[model samples]
Target: MKTFLILSFFALAVSALPLEESERINGENGWYLPQEDGSFEWVDMDVAEKWMEAQEQLESRGLTTVPVKFYLYTSSNPTKGTKITTTTNSIDASNFNAANPTRFVIHGWTQSYTASMNKDICSAWLSRGDYNVIVVDWSRARSVDYATSVMAVGATGKKVAAMINFLQSNYGMSLDNLYVIGHSLGAHVAGYAGKNTNGQVHTIVGLDPALPLFSYNKPNKRLNANDAWYVESIQTNGGSLGFLKPIGKGAFYPNGGQSQPGCGWDLTGSCSHGRSTIYYAEAVSVDNFGSIKCGDYQDAVSKECGSTYSGVRMGADTNAYMVDGDFYVPVNSEAPFGMIN
Candidate 1:
């Protein structure tokens, strides 16, 4: 009778602990926000509430008008970006090449063309190949309140779609060669652009798509597989600043997708969240960001991928054919983050 009572107590204690122990990267803790699909994600309550209020305001007042500007970069002019407009022969006037692969790098809230996301990605693409890198500068929408920036996603996305349409119609740039990459709030902007374009965009890469206001949002509102022909995501700060679950056909969870290595004691998860873009930028230049397919996020968190499952590259050269599951890729704490095969 004593043995039975002790066993029951032990079982209860184990059950009380967090389900996935591997997810607690960087030693961060927070409220567990329940997802629509009955799953729960750890999120900072303050940030979550701000986004929730923003979403509510957005639903009530509709999307706000945002002034979006485009800047083009190429190998010829890597540093100096040529301003491009949707109207009046801007593509023909600028150094826009329709033959090369085109990449649109959209920055997150409080970021502009000068942000590392735009500069580093542009430099990486140029170093890899002669690509057309267009930096979407929507800093005009930024305000003191982060919620106001959330409301501007829709309008900014429409402008991006309009620019895409203008390029396709007038400059003969094929959607097959287009890739839209966005980080944080910009990820949702990419989704909106893809939706506006009727999901005709070739690929959309979401780097740690913001979770605060977007975790419980509908597929049409957030970044999802239906947003593009091939949609993928790299979750660095999942369950906090970033969405916890797989938001795309190909979802990558590096270091459990919660906190990243080298980002020690990240209470707000900004360091880990920024790692998404950093990893992606490096992946664009190097072919070593390898990832193994997993049965689910649980498998990823445990680093015990099924041998039957195949591995795929987690960057610019990701396999479009092998998708539809979670992928786990280990990285170093510092530079040369990709692990050798």
Candidate 2:
């Protein structure tokens, strides 16, 4: 009887501990906002701007508008929550409306500061093109040795949930038509956000999602998809920074799981572990690779034993697909006939 009682007590005690205590620590090296004293702040707008500017410069070159919002959070208070600016002139999502305009949510790895800053720049550029953007900042610990082991991916996951709840409860925006983009470790953070939303997100684009530490190796409960139907698509180029394939069940790698030609261990060179938007856009464009066509060739030596090799032959003739006209219009009468890029 005493043994049974002791066992029961032990089990209860184990169960009482927070689930975070049991899971493996993930995203320890992630960024966070530093406090005034250079410790750690929940959200930092100053640092975020740097990341945002880099993204804006890249998007500007292509003349594509990318709406974004930057949210920052402290490491110690992952659930403390942060504010989101909207078109309604209100931080409250309830006041948001369809006519108010659509917004994109961008998150950073571990820390929300960098993500928020990046989103701000992206949003500024996109807003110039008339798209409203918002950043969802939440608290998350800074990347440190001890923090890495004790921190849980769930910490960021919970913050994402809070952001979604705010959107749903306050704004009427449907999860569908919502798009999310994350870079590096931010990719896994975005994945967790998408998973907890229960299929509300229409598309999720992971740019070189962090490997090994925070990947899709775990079971596919709600975080993974088998095809483009559920999660739309997962595009990767020069991934595998630390983890190995298959990152997820349906994770797509156009480069055959190999880093780009010039990528190196230090992440310099061609790979550089940068965004794959250009590569992704290229893969989808039929003009770049020609339409998929199949050609059959039987073994000449052994006609009895037939073998076929499918090939995609180009449509012949270079320069046949060149366009001769400029592709830009003035944003306003003040700037007449302005170039897009």
Score candidate 1 by TM-score against the native: 0.81
- Per-residue alpha-carbon lDDT of candidate 1 for residues 115-148, written as tens digits (9 for 90 to 100): 9878888998999878899999997445534445
lDDT of 2 at 87: 34
- Per-residue lDDT value at 283 in model 1: 89
* Candidate 1 residue pairs in clash (backbone atoms < 3 Å): none
Which segments of candidate 1 are over 4 A away from where they belong? 1-63, 306-309, 316-318
Q: What range of 10 consecutive residues in model 1 has the weakest lDDT sum? A: 25-34
Clashes of each: 0, 22
Off by over 4 Å in 2: 1-130, 138-141, 145-152, 215-217, 220-223, 226-229, 232-239, 242-250, 261-271, 277-341
Per-residue lDDT over 1-341 for candidate 2, one digit per residue giving the tens place of the 0 to 100 score: 22443344334434433224234232232223222233432212222333334433444474332223444222222323344543344444322343333434444344454443343334333433333344444343333321231123434544565565566666665665454555545555556667666456655545455443332434331234432123322233333342223333223332332343234453321243442333333322222322211121111111222222112111111211231111111111121201122
